[model samples]
Target: MSWGVATLGAPTFLTIGLLLARDARSDHPFFWPSLLGIVALSNAVAILRVNQSHRRAAFARRSVLALCYLRAGMAAGCAMFVVLGWSTGALQEMVATLAEMLDASAPAIAIVMGTWSLALALALAFGLASFAHAGALHAWIAFRRGAPGPRPGA
Candidate 1:
């Protein structure tokens, strides 16, 4: 789920940030290539992890299915945003802005640092979102398992 969330989020922030950095009236773009890459990577990792833990995953089919559904929804949402940005020309503006940044007079180190900083920020945000989503899922799972949750009395 962590990988899944990050996969869904990084491209999203990248496109949205690109649009904003463009100083254009519109602020949206789709990163379709990113969606393909993320979906593949996240699902592969999930399957691999489960297989590696086969002893514990003997009956984990439902959980994995739920994860797949979540990922598909994430991918669809990403596609929608990308299409929206494409229609509005926000994606093109973002490309232009990125090209200009690369062509700026700044030193190579400075540019690398700036780009790295942006990546880190996106990663941090994605990680937080992943954790939050996982927490919610965990709660739901526990509830389904009949684990006693906090209530009015001990």
Candidate 2:
């Protein structure tokens, strides 16, 4: 996959999420959540692309697998928050209306902090993914160029 989509997309989505959630205000409520879903899907696709390739260096394969798992976890976490925010909008709105009678504001945890947390988590996941992919690419190049790689059992 392209670095822009795989590497740069992560930080872009994370930044969007952070900005949307920063002041607990959003110009469009679903904007950040939709982007989060896209980020999750994009990461997942990148991992799958790596997995489906047969050209990976033997030594690099193991490390890349670990990175895949890390990305999966982060993707799942981000998707969860997005799903929750989307599914619970009406419920939260109702609660907010009800809360108006009892309190002046809605709950503090209404997707704002969750989005920020998702963004941070995605940042780590994406960083690891980039590192893993670059490592694999470099190793592949080295192998193609006949550079010496580690010997078995050595």
Candidate 3:
């Protein structure tokens, strides 16, 4: 259930972050750093909460699950970013610039840029998706604790 939630939630959060970052790029120089800080704080809080609630082994498992979700989210988010860029001709413009710089063909430049963009997107998505997953899990944990029924994991 967590995996399913992360699979959908991570990409959605990442796409939103990308859009916000794109908008902030033109105006706010501090946006990226501020966003990164927020994500870091969120992850820290989530880790601490999980650590306090579970044994070491369980914490490790949860950590691994979160990492897996983060990677999946990053890949999905990057695909979305590429599609959006292509639709907006942003990718073409970037490719054109790089192609001129390296005297390469447009297709080659596109492939290279696409690869680079994936890497870049992965880095950006790491924090964004991590925060999303952590936030989601945190909320879930809170709900589970508040519910009247017995807790399976607890």
Deviation in Å, model 1, residue 17 alpha carbon: 16
* Winning candidate number (TM-score): 3
Q: Which stretches of candidate 2 lie over 4 Å from their true place?
A: 1-9, 55-154
Model 2 over residues 1-154: C-alpha lDDT tens digits?
Answer: 4333443435556576677667746644664556556555555554555444424533345455445544554555445544554564633553344444443364677445544544455445544533344334323332232236799999
lDDT of 1: 0.45
Winner on TM-score between 2 and 3 is 3
What overall lDDT, based on C-alpha atoms, would model 3 receive against the true structure?
0.48
List, residue by residue over 1-154, the lDDT tens digit for candidate 3.
4433433344444664677667756333443334344443444444455444443334334445455434444444444445545555564565556545553455876767765665465446554644546544644543332225567888
Please report how far candidate 2 places residue 16 from its true position, in Å: 1.3
User: Model 1 segments beyond 4 Å from truth?
Assistant: 1-66, 103-154
**What overall lDDT goes with each candidate model?**
0.45, 0.48, 0.48
**Shift of residue 18 alpha carbon in model 3, Å:** 12
